[model samples]
Target chain A: MLRIILYSQWKWSRGWLLPVAVVGFAIPYFMLRVGYSGERYWDAAGLLEQVAAWGRGYPALAAAIGLLVGTSAWIHDHRGDHVYALVLPTPRWYYVLLRYTAGLVLLAPAMITVFLGALTATWFTTLPAGIYAYPIQLAARFMLATLLAYSLFFAIASGTQRAAGAVLTIVGIVVVTQLLAGIAGSDLNVLEAAFDRITIWPGPLEVFVGRWMLVDL
Target chain B: MPTMKLMLAIAFLLALPWRAMSGQAQDLAHVIDSLRERVSFWDSAAGYYDSITRADVDTVRVGGFAVITNGADLAAVEDAVNELRDRFIPIVGPDTILFQDKYFAVLGRGSHVVTEDIILAGLITDNITSQLHDAAQWYFGSETGRQFQSWLGPRVPITDSIAELPGIYEVIVLSPLTVVQRCHSGDIDACGASLALGLHQTPEEALRAWFNAADRRFLVGQLRPQWDYDLGRRADQTDGERRCIESESDADCVRILAGLYRSGMDVEAYAPGTNFHPSLPLDFATHSSLAAVALELGGDGAYSRLITSNALEPEARLEHAARASIDSVLRTWHAWVLRAAPPSVEVQPRSAWVTLFWVVVTAFLAAGSSRWR
Candidate 1:
């Protein structure tokens, strides 16, 4: 059952997933090419800045992949009003479990490609003293961050149309309240407060914060 | 042979410019013409200088600050001065005695001219307060007539945050000195050694007090370029310096450093681009953080206490001001420093576990979807 679900998910997301994985595989190489220029002596500070600039793309790529794969996991069922899922002998919870596991399985290609990409990139480049490439650490972080975003959007996408609408309505109300507060010259900012709560430490989004360096001291 | 070729190349480059000078003679004439042009330009600009001297300098006073400017934006300058006074009030106390008759002149944006007594900052800038704060440290320090340099460098106030503390943490962690690493690991004695508190030694004794033989050798290597420059300037390489660099003799390294100190190189070798005094181990931020912790523990009248206790040794003075044992104060500081360690590249275990918990929770939420009905 899990294998069938995995094959179905691959069929659905393969086109978009292939391109994203390819980009992920190419990114670390691109970072090395752009960061170092075969100078006899490397300025660690300047190299650090370049690596940091390239590192920002990982989280953004992870988010994109998560969004694509997570949505694709439920898109067919959602389009068919979940009739196929309803007709299956498996319980709805079991089906959801299968779909979630399937999505996670599909995430491996992108994760592995980036890991290999980082390894290849650092393999060719001679890093400065006290600096080392974190291919495995970077790959693990990418996988976890991808899973986080995937789970969040997956949960939302798995809901009924009305449930999704309720989520949107809540978001709309928050925006309206924030706008009203600003217009009335109040210091209240609901969006900013919500963002801080979501992005700060211990927040689910905190993983995306701070330097995601591939090569660091 | 390479050195000979390098010198020949330099000589050739220098001669290239003047090789045609005597033959053409037109080059010399052009140089004279350019110099004359520059003189005339300066002669014409003298009128502008005369106008500036003749123009009235406007004075803007706010709280304890008095700024003299060319009447461009007195209102903005007034606000900036008021803000600076607000910042300084916390660090220096409410007593306006130190601020009395201190005049600052603003000439243009981001420019500060410092005389013996007066700090003239030119124009309004985003960093006006920071620039003024830096200059005022010296002015205030001089007014207090206390030597606070034994432990802290300039005693600058530090505002700690995630973005700020990690840099200082990196310094302590990545330092070559074992004492600094131990300090980071919460060793109070190591913290004292690293901070060099209560050590009344000359700069050489101070360096020896903080660093061991291997540590001194490492420092010598790091400061090799500066030592080479100083040696080359005198055109004399001492036996100690020669042995230190060539034979990697640690004792020779220490001796050369002592000579450098006796010959006028002090804290300048350790911390360049800072107006620091001798015998301090850590950088400005790290010292400031410790001082800040002391001040916070001391609470009300802490700044006054700190200033008055300057006659005592650094650790005694800090303890006196904070009204706490040196051990407690240093332990607290060491804990704070540890907490500020740089964020890791790998995902933290807590973060990973928390993320997993959330994933499971969200997955369960997805399973309970009303669409399943």
Candidate 2:
């Protein structure tokens, strides 16, 4: 059953996996090279600016991998009307688990690539004092972010089109409510309050906040 | 056919001119020239404004004459001072009347000191002193003042007791002993007045006054019920440290005290002083005390407003802005600061190499696995 699941995931995503892996590995190495080369004459401020600008790429990579992997996971099933999956001699939960596990397994290589890239980047650079490189931590964060994106997208893809529409509608309602409150000139700091609630302590997205410093105190 | 060809040629020729005109209009050279002119104008204006604002503040700070009073009133007095050289000193005609605390101090040269003294003597006549003192006694003798006087009595004696403690000499040698002696002898109002005056005499006296003032202010500012406990603990720690010092180790005590003084001075150096004394304006130390007092009184709003209004002039604002911008740029300069791995002193190239090696190997294995399936 595991073999069948792996084969199916591979058949669906093989075209995208190679390019993404290469790009993932190259990102950290390229960033390090450019950053180090600029470090000689550039002051700490300039260097940090350049590094933060490049840091945006990590989230982008995670989201892309998630979206692509997720879309692929459902594409074949959708094309075949999901008839083959429903006919399988297993519970729907088992099928979903198998699919999720397979996608995670495939995601491991890209995660490894990020880790390698970060490690290599750290190895080559001469970090300033009071700073530490956390390649393992960076890799772990990248993995978690990727997994989160993948899981979210996978859940969306697995749902009926109506379910996806309902989720989008709820998001739209929240955004509209916030926008109206802003236009009404009420000191209704809904958006900022919502953002703080979501990004601060106890929020799922809290990990992304604070400092993303690869080398931090 | 020839007519059609001519029409097409004319249209093409007209289009060329239009495109050229648009290109010329959009030329970056013109934009750069305009930007340069605007920036130059702004830069000149900013510079002029900065200088004018600084000059205005300086003039305001030294507008009045500060008569140096070194009597009993000079004991433990804390006040801000601003200085001006003789050449730019404003002359209030000799016959002009000046009120204490109302007019700013203008320190003039010794050449005119005798003339200024004669003028000031006429202004602060005995009649005025007696009148002001009587007014103060009357007000302070009233129910409100009596209540305050009674409330103040216990606190003053406690302060005197603290000042008279044997180790007080280690902190402040002159004013504390004089103040304690004065207070112990039942000259309560005089003692209070002396302490206030001593703080204004010199920077050192001002600092000692400021230290005591800060502790008192801190205690008053704390809203928590446990603040007393916290303050007591802090006081105990300070007392313990003071008591631990051996009188025989005066040199060591001096060194330690000097270090502590330097730390306080350093903080003051970054702060702004008040405009009270003409000959010697408050130094960084005095300014820091004032800033601390402002903060203790009203929190960050008071502190920020005082510094912004009194200390941060146009020139200082520009300097601060430039510093902040540069600091921000430095913070983001390194991708190195973003590394997720715990850095070791020695670079570990092995982890990178191994990871890369395995990634390639895994990719190939994945590819091969797909082919087999």
Candidate 2, residues A1-217, lDDT tens digits: the string is: 9788888889888898988988888876766556554221112333444555666787788889988886687778778887887789876666767777788888999999888878887887876433457778777667766776676677677777766788889778778888898899877876677788755554444444433334433
Q: State the lDDT of candidate 2 residue by residue for B162-207, as single tens digits.
A: 2222222111111223333343344433333322322234444433
Best by lDDT: 1
DockQ of 1: 0.41
Give TM-scores for every candidate, taking all chains together and pairing residue i with residue i. Answer: 0.67, 0.41
Q: Compute DockQ for each candidate against the true complex.
A: 0.41, 0.02
Stretches of candidate 1 exceeding 4 Å from the true structure: A15-58, A74-97, A111-142, A158-184, A200-217, B1-62, B67-91, B122-135, B141-155, B158-166, B185-189, B196-202, B224-242, B259-281, B293-332, B342-373
Report the C-alpha lDDT of model 1 over B208-326, residue by residue, as the tens digit. Answer: 77877666665555452333365353134556666776688877877766765456526655445543223235665676677777766776566667666655577776787677887
Which ten contiguous residues of candidate 2 chain B have the minimum total lDDT?
Answer: B151-160
Runs of candidate 2 with Cα error greater than 4 angstroms are A38-42, B1-373
RMSD, one per candidate, in order: 9.5, 28.7
The residue pairs in collision within model 1 are B106-B121, B107-B122, B108-B122, B108-B123
For candidate 1, the per-residue lDDT at A147 reads 91
